[model samples]
Target: MAPHLGDWRGRYRGAAIAVVRPASTAEVAAVVRACAEAGVPMVPQGGNTSLCGAATPGPDALSVVISLSRLKRVRAIDAANNTITAEAGCVLQTLQEAAAQAGRLFPLSLAAEGSCQIGGNLSTNAGGVQVLRYGNARELTLGLEVVLASGEVWDGLRGLRKDNTGYDLKHLFIGAEGTLGIITAAVLKLFPLPRATATAWLAIASPAVAVRLLGDLQASFGSLLTACELISDLALGLVRKHLPGSSPTLSPSSWHLLIEVSGGDDAQAGQQALEAFLAEALENGTVNDAVLAQSNEQARRLWALRENIGEAQKIEGLSIKHDVSVPISRIAEFVERADRQLAQAFPDIRIVTFGHIGDGNLHYNQSKAEAGDNAAFIAAQSAVNRIVHDLVHQLGGSISAEHGIGQLKREELLRYKSPVEIEMMRAIKRTFDPQGLMNPGKLL
Candidate 1:
């Protein structure tokens, strides 16, 4: 429990009877069955990298943590079907590399890809920057191999794209956060590897302008617009301050956009189209300033700025964080309203806002400029959450976006979810896990 009990944020610690390492599907089933017979609750753990304490056991000290790290394996790769079957413990980055090795692309990407596990990714339905083009972990997944709470192995790992045979059971497990069953393996969708990729850093005026630029890019480039990340000046300042040797990607502006476009199998294809668009965009006054990467090295540096925001925030101080999403058309409104509301309540509240704006998700977090005051500011988390989440609700947005409703958001979920929807979810939980043995005190 020393390693698995704590989440990536180090904000949660759990007490479990023991942590069990299961190497195979049979072993996982056996362990689950034993726990079932003993009437002991079981927590299915992956890489222990969840932001919401999903994999961490409760403080009861009565549950067993089933660590799936030992089950790392690429079970099979069907490039013809554009799918790959991987075990629960396979690291997300390893799966991405494996897909590239097979001349395909597995587009489930995030900063934690190197440490996060496939099962957990699917379980949480993680959405990264590429979700603008591809989709969330749930969309990339085709089928699943789950260990039911009864200890029965359900092998539904079929790579068929048009399986409307019945209810999409895989979805029940994906994004379920292990409340229903354990995701042992999955058949994940893949795409043709991009031959040419272009990356650019743009100085934007505001969130509204970013949205306009996004629409323009999508209109011209279509689905080739792979990623569009939004970073406020405050967020970028944090990156520059904490990440040594990191320089600004463009002239300092109120906001910066890290954009990328990818096209099919032409190593030299991306630069020209992006260059043309930027030329037109500049002439029309959609963007303030821009720097198109001349080389992959430059591109990586530009990307590092966006990827390192979370780390920079950690180096600064504790913060109240909210991963919320609104409709793409209303993203600017959400940001404007939320920022104004927060500022009115907490003067000089340093706000760090950035995310996959193309997909309508924002990592909106707040802290004080001073490290000591930030600690006290952190105590107003509930108050901060109420303001942010209330506005998100007003905008028809979700309180929890990419992150799952783990123990952290159970109360929030109950508060926001409609009574009928909550009842249906609870009924499903009862049907799937009547004993409440699987990941107790989570999600529901």
Candidate 2:
């Protein structure tokens, strides 16, 4: 019960009357039915790896937490159809392994893939580094099995890519953050595993340059380009300081781009092509320095630097984190303006920016120097959020990108969302959970 009560980031601590582990979809339905009969609120939790407190119950509510960790099973794999049916509690890495064992690829990946369950990934519509090629959790999903707020099982888990049969009800629950219903099982799309891959880390002048390099890579490689991540000097510095020896030292630059290209069935061909592109970019002065991974082990080491940014930040200290997204064309402008404004408001502010720049999502975070009191720096989260989120909104972007509107950003959701949009979301909530028992005080 205690382990299931808190979020991964240590930002949210909650209380629940009892935590019940349901072994199957039927057991989940029974748990919901029993809770519904007593009119008790319920929180459907998976992995408990939510950074935004999405899985944590409210502190005051005596709700029943329905843990889906027990429902871990890979139901079936249709290699011919390129789909895998898995239970909600199936760990994301496990699903990826299962897909690989079936001679397929499940590309929905993130840093928390080792522990985070597929249920939470679907609920949050998670976007990872591979979103540039594979798309997010929502895009990869074909069907879902949900236990509605009324304790009724809705088995819509069909592995059909072309189901134009009435409304696409599966989408209503995906990215809904479990406010509508509990996802029990899902049929996810898969792809042919890439035999050859090319990864490189490039030191660029700034975000503008990174964006430009992204364009050039897209023009040259097209669908072969799988991931393009942008990282700031400060963000890398933290990783180097806290997690020493984890990443190789590279040329010092204001910004860095970690890009990968995968295709074909031959490794040398892919590497040669990427190497040629990098050499040309270097000669043209677009790239300051570049390191193309010589082998698969080296590529994994390079990716570790990008994936460990969040953990490194935690070790550094408390920071105000903002997961925002803008159009790919406007990323440079958003960063330039936001950095200036935040620096002016809080002097000597250490802003750490990094994320999937290919998809326009940036994890912009801020903390103070070693001499400064981080407690005081964290106290200014509201002012920091205002400067960052307002610019994101002004640039026609989203306040909450991959991280959903959990307890952390409920107010920001209202602040940025239009009245009409808010009303529509509320209407959907009312329609799905009329009794308001499904994960209350969440996205709505």
Q: All candidates: CA RMSD in angstroms?
A: 1.1, 1.0
| TM-score of each candidate structure, all chains considered together | 0.98, 0.99
User: Looking at candidate 1, what is the lDDT of residue 338?
Assistant: 84
Overall local distance difference test of candidate 2 = 0.93
Candidate 1: global Cα-lDDT?
A: 0.91
Q: Would you list the clashing residue pairs of candidate 2? A: none
Best by lDDT: 2
Q: Give Cα-based local distance difference scores for all models.
A: 0.91, 0.93
lDDT of 1 by residue, 1-444 (tens): 599888877778999999999999999999999999999999999988787889999888999999999989999999999999999999999999999999999998898888889999988999998999999999999899999999999999999989889798998998999999999999999999988999989988999999999998999899999999999999988888899674544666898899999986665667988988998887888877889998889888888888889889888877888999999999989888888999999988989999999999999999998877888888988899999998889889999999898988899898899999999999999999999999999999
* Sliding window of 10 residues with minimal summed lDDT for model 2: 243-252
Please give the clash total of every predicted structure, in order. 0, 0
User: Which portions of model 1 miss their true places by more than 4 Å?
Assistant: none
lDDT of 2 at 316: 80
